[model samples]
Target: MQIKANNPDEYIAQIPEDRIPYFKKLRQTILDNIPKGFEEQMSYGMIGYVVPKSLYPDGYHCDTNLPLPFTNIASQKNFIALYHSGIYASPEILDWFVAEYPKHCKRKLDMGKSCIRFKKAEEIPFDLIAELMQKLTVKNWIKIYEQTIKK
Candidate 1:
């Protein structure tokens, strides 16, 4: 949803009540497993895990004022969306995630280039997401971003 939140907690608070637990768990999953150097914040109106500007002063190429986004989770109108920039920039990571999805969840994988959409709340594979979160560090991500995505 289009939550007018100023921070990650505010974004979580603004999500629908029924989804609060799911969102919270998703947030915790990322927080618990994400590599160091990624800070939590509200990014693009969603709960974002990012490389803060302090660490990477260049910031996101698309918007230098914003932190370098690594991943984001949002409660969308129809589903929960997880956006992972690493998977978008690295084919090896993408292929690994794709191959491993079915092993973690029963539902068919519903995904885009960088967005993984979960239509059913209970079907979200938090463990898989946690594993994905640990795959990249700020240094690795910036390198990949520079080599494959930054323009």
Candidate 2:
């Protein structure tokens, strides 16, 4: 679902009430695990963690006015979606996550290039996600982005 919100709080408030606790926990997990320098804000209609302009002055290449998005979380119609640019940009991280997913989650991973979809709240693997969050620091992400995604 597309939620139009000014901030992360507003975004979570619009998600299904029943999933509030889970989303809150998931959000907290990211906040606690993601490396320092990534700022939380409303990004692309979801809760996002980004490298602020102060760190990467160029910001997102697609839009210089915005920060460089590192990750995002959103409550979709059928699942909770996590978008991690690191996995998309770094093959090593993707391979690590792919190999480790089965150990943490019973369901086969439902994923796209960068989006990990958890169809049920109980199926989400917070611990694995936390580890994934720590794999990429702001400097590492920017370096990867510049080398691979920025063009």
The lDDT per prediction is 0.92, 0.95
lDDT of 2 by residue, 1-151 (tens): 8999999998998999988889999999999999999999999989999999999999999999999999999999999999999989999999999999999999999999999998888778999999999998899999999999998
Candidate 1 wrong stretches, greater than 4 Å: none
lDDT of 1 by residue, 1-151 (tens): 5989898888878778888898899999999999999999888988898999999999999999999999999999999999999889999999999999999999999999999999888889999999999999889999999999997
Which candidate comes out best when scored by TM-score? 2
TM-score on alpha carbons, each prediction: 0.97, 0.98
Q: Report RMSD (Å) for each prediction in the order shown.
A: 0.8, 0.6
Model 2 TM-score, all chains together: 0.98
TM-score of 1: 0.97
Number of the top-ranking candidate, with lDDT as the measure: 2
